[model samples]
Target: MGKEKTKIRLRGHHLFCSNVMDVDGDPIYSARFCANFRKYQQMMADPSQAIEVVCTCGDTCRYCPSWNEQDGKCRLYDYPPNANRIDLEMLEALSLSVGDEITSGELKQRIKGRFGTTLPAMCSWACGFESVLHCSQGQRKL
Candidate 1:
């Protein structure tokens, strides 16, 4: 018998970015973003355990035109003493770090504090949804 495939359960914020596109203007459903997201998703599946956030810097930045591949950094956010830094400040402010287990509610609260809003509010500006249906309907929540 073949091994069963694990179903990846995604949260609300994950859903918000699930339909985001990549640099080539293709849906990121099967990309590294999904892989990384699944990693965290698996960890957070246990309600009693604290979820370990690998990084506060969301994957959406990878598709941004300003992302510099050569240096593995964002041109718009990187500066001296903070080279290759994405959302470090936000992460630190929220007291979140790699391998630190945290509750889902805690995670959501910190995310809200960092962005000063919800994922949908932020996605409206960052995500470039090519489909008219997605843009019109999806962006309405922003």
Candidate 2:
């Protein structure tokens, strides 16, 4: 993947993945995730906005609509305990030893096509709904 430029203000910002996914188990909307990704990369470039990560979900989680029927906790299953919030930790951990800044280039190479994309079904419904809601009147930005 080629080098893609990201903003500076959002650099080093990170967000933990919530249990927001679809039946097929793909990320529903990349907005929050991608936004954080951009922030992390930006922080890497500038080194001023270094941030930490927190794992709210404990472990062994995944979202499955049929979880109850399958005798499984699909919601928890969809979101693993510590799997989602590793990005910020990874960056903080990496900063101790690494001297050079982490560029979007490296991130792209690591995530490959997985970055900057949203699952089709989830994106259309959930993401679309969110986009509409965010742009709607009487709604405040959180």
Candidate 3:
């Protein structure tokens, strides 16, 4: 018998934020949306590999009214119409493929440059977090 290779699935938002490490230096998500993404980030250095993607909504979808629990997908998947466009553009800008390996710093810098804000700010805005850390601190205007 051969060992089974685990397939890593990534949602659109993972491209923007890396996993946050806990006190013990363990990575954790603020929500339940990105198990495979977190794992993929941990395992792969180049993110160009083929990956299954569900949506770009990210962790903020937890509180979104349009989140379709039954399907485990986003109701607003095409709401912005350009949602996929943005995701593709972001991937292209970062030079990342579905499973291509990349450094966290490099990904963050690419995201910051493309979005004109910090990753936390981007996550906050995407997830609709009430307190946007960067904006609140006046670090970088979003």
Candidate 4:
């Protein structure tokens, strides 16, 4: 059988998660969001390394130019970091370094289970919201 291709869907401009605390040796929020950064560029130099992210919104992600024209649903905005569809090969490689090997996925979930920054996601959402072609002035909550 041919190798199965992985598809990574990145709807937002950037990815982020809460940081883990250092005291309990919890996964840092920055570390979680930036796990790929920890993998070192050499490891991800290959376009095949990838990760799957669920965008709260579909491909119409407010940021894409095609959003309004296509009713917030379009393929142009959905793709792996390399512009290719999701590729499991890329994710497997990234997991080796960024994510710990767990037969059932990482056992240690929730970075310290502590939420430090509530504004980051809001900031990100606001940014994407504004990028929408039809957003009204002063309509942004942030």
Candidate 5:
């Protein structure tokens, strides 16, 4: 048998972003961010791989150009820290919380069940999130 994969650690809101958006070759995101996203996508290849929800900057943010190590949030909205606020909102929508462990398929199904026909309330507000598309049904901006 093949080696088992470890959990995919990501921020709370990134769970939704991963489900909705595809940023594969988008210039808006830095090359490092794009590369990390690809690896994240691959991590989901095993449906059983656990998705660990985090409050601080997770694997996805580690490679983001706008990542802020000092505050452990995105540089955009640094004053109000909307990134952290938005993450909490997303977690509420999904009935999840930081440190929670869930499978990718379960998270996807929850997303579909909760917001399949409507825009996520968290995404409805514009916080200037640099990488993930804030609107337009989660399609790639480029």
Candidate 6:
């Protein structure tokens, strides 16, 4: 009998941000968040590792400082509205839907082919979106 491996679930926007952002040396996040993210990064070091796309609060969110177990959502997002907004944009830009399975390498190629190294950052907040994404919508994120 063959055993099947469970796919790693990652938030949609994380597909991009994870490449540029590092939780190490950052004190803003909870230890659990850092640990989980680091583990994800380590796993991504493998080219064959598959990542499941998700736009909602996911595994990483479980360790996020803003995550409230009782509410089962990030406090920064109202039932996933604000957070979903960012993730939805990433999915729309990539022309992908939730549940799509992709390797980080393939996704990176797609991003390069589509945006040519940078995607427009539409984040309205000072969340450092500029570091990884450029703003196409100018000052606001829709």
Question: Which numbered prediction scores highest in TM-score against the true structure?
Answer: 5
**lDDT tens string, model 3, 1-142?**
9765444454555455433321122223333434433455555344443344344454334434566666556664534555555456456666666445454445545656666634443344354432432233332422
What TM-score quantifies how close candidate 1 is to the native fold? 0.37
Clashes of 6: 3
Report lDDT per candidate: 0.42, 0.30, 0.46, 0.29, 0.72, 0.65
On residues 39-139, what C-alpha lDDT tens digit does candidate 1 reach at each position?
54455444443443443234434444564667645564455665424344334656655445556555544544554433334345333444522433332
TM-score of each: 0.37, 0.22, 0.41, 0.21, 0.78, 0.74
- Model 4, span 1-142: residue lDDT tens: 9886443333332222111111122132233323442332223224454433443322213343334444344444334343422222223322332222222122112211222223233334323432332222212211
lDDT for each residue of candidate 6 in 39-132, tens digit (9 for 90 to 100): 8777776766788987566666667777777855556653534657767777888778899998867876666666664444744441654533
Clashes of each: 3, 20, 13, 18, 0, 3
Ordering by lDDT: 5, 6, 3, 1, 2, 4
Better of 1 and 5 by TM-score: 5
Q: What lDDT score goes with residue 8 in model 5?
A: 82
The CA root-mean-square deviation of candidate 6, after full C-alpha superposition on the true structure, stands at: 5.8
Residue-by-residue lDDT tens digits, candidate 2, 36-132: 4333433443433332222322111222232343433233222556332333343353341122343333433332233223322323432344443
In terms of lDDT, model 5 sits at: 0.72
Q: In model 6, state the lDDT of residue 136.
A: 38
Candidate 2 weakest ten by summed lDDT? 10-19
Residue 120's lDDT in candidate 4: 31
Error at 135, model 6, angstroms = 14
Prediction 2 global C-alpha lDDT: 0.30
Which candidate, 1 or 2, would have the higher TM-score against the true structure? 1
Top lDDT prediction, candidate number: 5
> What TM-score does candidate 4 get on C-alpha atoms?
0.21
lDDT of 5 by residue, 1-142 (tens): 9887778888877887776566666544687777777688777756777999987777777667678877776775334645478778788999999999999878877877877656666554644453454434553221
Question: How many times do residue backbones clash in model 2?
Answer: 20
Instruction: Please identify which of the two predictions, 1 or 3, would achieve the higher TM-score against the true structure.
Output: 3
